[model samples]
Target: MISLKPRWRSTLEKHRAKSARTERSGSVRLRIVAWTFLLTSFIITGLIFTVREILISDVGRGANSSTESEIGEFRNFAQIGVNPQTARPFETLEDMLGSYVTRQYTGYKEQVIGLTPHQIIFLEEQDHYALTTGYRLHQDQALLTGLRENPSNSGIEQTPAGPVHWGKVAVELRTDQGTTTGHLLVLEYIQPELDAVQHTVFIMIWVGVAGLAFTLLVSWLIATQITKPIRNLRQVAEHINDKNFSGRVTVKGDDDVAAMSHTFNKMLDRLEEATLTERQFMDEVSHELRTPITIVRGHLELMERTEEQEQTLLLVDDELERMGRIVSDLLTLAKSERPDFVQPHPTEVSELMISLDSKVQVFANHRWIIADIAEGEVGLDEQRITQAMLQLAANAAQYSPSGSAITIGSEFYGQGGERQLKLWVQDRGPGVSPEDASILFERFRRNNAKNPATAKQHSMGAGLGLAIVRSIAEAHGGGVWIAAPEDGPGSIFGISLPAPSPPKKTQSITATYPPQNEPEKS
Candidate 1:
């Protein structure tokens, strides 16, 4: 015996396991076909055997009836004491017996035997006894002896040629003297019936062989049809495991297996979508991080403790902080695919507006005012929605002048079955063009056109804020959009949430803005 390496042994074991599974599947199909053929063969063979036995029984009954009729004819002749052919009375008992024997010897298929007290004579002739065997003659003698003693004899004897149905009747010869006792024997040959049964059995054996072959062929075809779909499904699953989601099994009919294939395809679609999302996220992260990393690295390469070097350090620290925010926003967007990303609860619109108004004041020296606030409980994730609204307010403040008015508002509006909760931040700033609005909410995207207010801001953020806002809105089964105000020279960025049912009680809260004190620009 040769010893194998551990790796080789593992490979061999895996191959064997796979082969075993294949064999087991084939064996299941084979068992189905084999059992079906065997059951059909058993039923057909049983029917043939039953028919053969019934035919044999019918043959036996026919032979017995013929034997009884022959015995009755012999008794009638003996009682008349006359020649059946000549229509004349006999002078002696021997003459009457001889005449009856000669009349019965017709030289046909039937045989008759006559018995007296002294001798046994075959009525046909000596040459006609060629078909009879010694065993048959001995059985006939025994039957005659029984008739002489008891006067009623009937029996079936198994001879070398086949079976023989024989019957005997005792007769009395009546004359002027007295009556003499004689015996008459009737024999029926059953070789013809036995031959017919044998021939039929022989034919049925061939028929059974043909039937078994046909049954096996049909069973194999049916089994293949049933297992073909399952085999294809297995192959498709293997392809999917290889990260090839394009392969799909053909669904030929509305069966359970077809439904399974449909479900498998749907699973592949989800996998592909997730894979694309992950790939895009990685590409965006790498591209966005590279510029800030290069800036930090360039500043660190210069080893000097000058005032300009101190400013470079500050810029590096700011870039690092911006990078941190980008990473955090990316994580939030990624988590939007998860089921627990947003935990919704009933929140009043006025409470949300008050929270936004308080948070927006710290971002800029703008005149932050609540333009409007709607009251009513709506289902929303308080923290996530607050984060998104605050980000929009910060964006508006960044693009507007230091003393420009930034208005935050919420409202409930709809008709019939459709209802919505709309929250918006409006700013008196350089408005975004319609073309730039399309890609404004995508990751790492920013408006290239410089605003004077944005240039004055010391810390320019990495452009993931709006994208995070969109992700949060979409997580709540809603959306965010940017629109230019119809009568104003600024943009209105808003988020809309579907409110299937809102609380009936309504109230309004308006915030009074403090007196604007403009700080002189440096």
Candidate 2:
């Protein structure tokens, strides 16, 4: 057994691991290119095969066509017609065939020959391209014997000049020398046809190889471009750590890969923002709770005598009350997350605003006024809406000057199907600051306490009021928002709630209402 030093072994292990990762990543591009080339190879091979088969079929058809053409030309000469081969009319059957064999239409593959009862005569042959053996079918005794013994109308014979297909036409003419009789033969050499097919197949093979090389190059380029995004994603993942996660994939197109990258970016943004919010929340909780504890400790530590018990108790009691309000607000927010938190029933919107106006009269000395009211029935938890509105009014009252007007209003705005309700409270105070607007509804987060105008206000409670307002609004499938008051020097805080679907516009029966004498249920 051999052992290496620790550092050397670790280095080798790391190197091997990196090599495996690289191989895995490279496989994606390799497989894509490989499959592409494989399919293209199949297509190219199929085209080459089909073309070669078609050319080979044409070889046989060409032979048949040449035989028929020669026969047709000779039949015309048997009649009183001019022989183009000799540029003269036939004097006899022998002259006609002899002149016919010399026609320009007769090529190397196609030949004309004549035969009689005694021996071969009027043999016309042309030089063949493939068979250098010259025309042997005209003189070969074996072919002649085969023709005499087995006189086929047309047949193939292997002669000295490769394979030859012979077509024979017996001729008879009424000349002065009685009825003359002889056989006219059309010989088509098959060697040239075979050579042509072979030549074509060779050319196709070279073209197919070129096409395959081109396909390979194109497939590699496409695969490399396609895998570029995946490589970027892998790089981002490798560097994604808790402390450093700013890496992002560059989106290039509106394709699926771009959508995936966009969704991933959104998820990262949410996670980072959530982490920062959680840390800020923890810090605020500590500070808010620590303040009361410090105050109580200070009071008890400096008292130092029984005579100061009443005063110290009073001071501690105030701090304890402040802590109690914070606990109550937190509990209310937690309960608002439950499904039954806001049980809505149909209530007259205008009547509910009136009820709120009466209830908020004693919350502070500010002159509370109903700015406006919308007339309709809305689905809402009457007590909850009142409480949410009262919370907004209370916040306004705490910040506004004595006897200043704190406006309360409600309105309806929507179309198609269902309408929504916007209930708001306007306060005449030092309008909202830019820095405090973003975190106004966060728990344990009050408005800019550093502002002297805000600190001077006697507002002493946890900043969970607006958070509770937001929870109530969301429970009704709505949201809360803040805006600047129109024609005013203050800010407007509002909650928008989705009203339940309205009653039908037209009715077949008369409209009716419950008698006023009947008391409503609690």
Candidate 3:
């Protein structure tokens, strides 16, 4: 036997397990959302970088145009060997070049100013360069190489120098400043603005990447926090959905989730109370209906002979009688649920059996093999006991094979004077399954479809006969059960009612039932 407390605990434990499962699921969803946000950040960063690259290339090209003009003037001075100090056009040119570099650098700061030293070197090395006065300006040497190697790498061709890298521009100028035509030592190169922009691009990429990672981490945590409660609510709801209404979530705070939990628990309480009330009402209603039906049946039977309509009235009376019986059985089931339903009285077992034998004989086409009715007395409600036996007899007679015997028997059961009264109705009909037997006594339950129609046609208690039988027996502190007989064909339905205290040990009178050839009992 299982303990009731453990069963209750098991139910709660299952809900906790389910809650844990939901928490895990929430964590997984949070991870997915976090990853999605992180990926989006990366994509956006890439797009920004691409757009800035294009803009820088365009700006660099414009700056390169001015730088090229300045370089031409410097070259004209160099060709004439006129010092830059005395070169008038060259002096204007030098100032223009310096201003252009400074302006370009300042403008680029608005987009990507935090270029690392390594990135600056990498950017400058993208091109080729030439030194002024045959001496390399350490700061400008890298620019010479970059201009020679990466003409178009700067996203512009405003200068003409070396490789066709984007944004690159280069210019060839005459070394003689005053000379209109002279040998122009090709000393053109890319501007430092292109190198600065590339360096800034690298620095911005790192910063954006770090920011994206931090954003993703925060987003994941937030998503997890939000969805955790939702998942808990889902799991608890599922438990209730599965009929485990005792479960409740832990209300952490006065958030929406807590409010929802409170509401859910309240709903469960109402549902439980309503369910109990409805069951009580049904029981009371079913029980009350029986008394009126019985009274109606008795009244209808009394009116049977007095009606003057003869045969038609008789048929109507029969139908009315069937309906009355069905209602009475339904009421009996209801009554069984009451605390006062059990009202046992002293009744001789022998006398009850004799009465039952005679009554059931009217419905039997085959003989009833009734065991000797012991002369002992037991406590039982006389009317209810009779009703139960009649239902059993009716069931056997209606469903059994033609002329098959129904054995009604009683025997002593239990040890140490724990007396039990056993009454069984056995028939050689198809047996019910173990699973079906569990619910055989439920109201409106039919064993199979075949008999439901027949029972309806006969108005035979609305399929509640067996249910009433079980209910009555249980009300008398007993249980009824059905199973296949081990001896061979058919089913055996039996009730084991508590025997009367101080059981009478009297002898019984056996009643033998021989085989019958007639269609009806005589």
Candidate 4:
């Protein structure tokens, strides 16, 4: 046998365990349904038996009444010495018993017997003479003794067929000079009554079976529907456990199961997002670090203690500074993905524009002007927004000619009951193409159509400034984009922030700038 590796063996065991759990879940549901149906069936059967006993007791009571009426008729005959039907006297004991039995007995299962202390004197029945012929009154001595000992007695006898309900009456027969005592026994074979009840019981049994079968079918269907979604959710969880988050359970009705499935799907969405972010972070780090490290390595290898050694050292320091900036920008971008990236507070828009005007003046000898300032406070991370606005200004300075007019401004625009603060830097520079505009804010991306004279004059730093700007704007729940002026041959780069709720009192400030005095050409 070939032995499996540890990881493979563990995976196989987990699969087996999961399959077993799944199977057990279905089996557990089936068992619950089956047991419930069986319990209900047994309860109904017991009720049927209870009702059967009540009906059988009623039949026994009716038989006793009939037996009592027969005994009363015989007692009247013996006391009056006359038959009420014929209005005549002089009847023997056997004759009286025969007459009374023939008159009182109405059903095939009923019998009447007359007995003395010594022998069975008379018996009458509808049919089945063997029952009377084989039943020896002397053989039931204990029963006879009980009847003689008691004036009237009633009891049940279990027979081969079923049961017999008997009522006995002891009486004394008297004529002018003689007296004789005998017993009158009335017997009812309860088999036919029991047979009727048994027939009803058989019908009830069939009904219970049908009901139980239906119950099982309905319970199985209900159980399957309830557990189906749970099974699907488990499968999806297993897929997610295997690092695949694309699987989702199908939600059915508005129930607990549906809610659970919805929550599971949402968890998968977050997991996918986090996994993608981690992979992107690693890729960006590796790609951004490689070039600077290679440049540092190349410069150090070629270093010589000559006249150019200082310049080479300066070049290495510049590359190291560039690497540091790249690392800082990457760190900022990574942190921006977190929840606490921006600490927002209310900052007046006019003050913000004035700050931007002062900050961007030192970047280049451009005719920097504050075109407009919207007078309102906006919730913003002041330092981060200033950093983003300054990056846009520096980008404008790079692309435009020296002494060119680069306008920095802020404004409020309202639409659909929502207000936003727009901070922009407009420059008369090489306008970006639509295709380039889409990707200009991504990391390590730059426009190829740079001013050749300026490109040769200044070292183009790492292309992470715009990306950092975008990250800051996104962290503030805002965004940055580039737009072309309708009439000007340049682009406007701006960031829009959601304006804060207005304060109780409002203030406005306005400033206008004159055209810059141009230096006279020599």
- Could you say which candidate leads in lDDT? 2
lDDT of 2 by residue, 1-522 (tens): 111111111122344578678757756778987898889889888988898788867766787778888788778766655656567665676666666665545656766777766556543334343246645566666777566456677877787666777777888766566777788777788787788778888888888888888888988888889888877877786666433457787878999988888887787787777755654564457557757766766766676657657787766767676776676676676567456889999899999998998999986668888878989888889989898999999888777767788889888767635678889888887777656776677666676533244453445677889888877887887777677765657778888788756666985865445656687776
Looking at candidate 3, what is the lDDT of residue 62? 57
lDDT per residue, candidate 1, 1-522, as tens digits? 111111111122344568678757655568889899779888888978998898888888887888787777766776676676668876656666666666765343355676766656566453445554433443455655664575348777666657777777776666788776767667777777878997998898889888889988988888888888877877777656312367777788898878987887788888877876785786578567767766666666565668867887777767676676666676676666566889999988788888888888897578987877878888899999999999898888788877888888887768524788888888788877655676777777776654665774424676888888887887787777665666567778888787776346879986554424655555
- Model 4 poorest 10 in a row by lDDT: 1-10
Q: Looking at candidate 3, what is the lDDT of residue 47? A: 75
The TM-scores of all predictions, comma-separated, are: 0.48, 0.45, 0.39, 0.49
Higher-TM-score candidate among 2 and 3? Answer: 2
How high a TM-score does candidate 2 get?
0.45
| Worst-scoring 10-residue span by lDDT in model 1 | 1-10
Model 4 root mean square deviation, Cα atoms: 21.3
In candidate 1, stretches whose alpha carbon ends up further than 4 angstroms from where it belongs are 1-4, 7-16, 75-82, 86-101, 104-109, 129-152, 254-522
Clash pairs, candidate 1, are none
lDDT of 3 at 54: 85
Model 3 lDDT vs. the true structure? 0.59
- Per residue, candidate 4 scores C-alpha lDDT tens digits across 32-147 of 68887878888888988897888788878877777677667667766776665778764456555555655664456666676765555444343344465454332466755665
Which residue pairs does candidate 4 place in steric collision? none
Model 3 vs truth, CA RMSD = 18.3
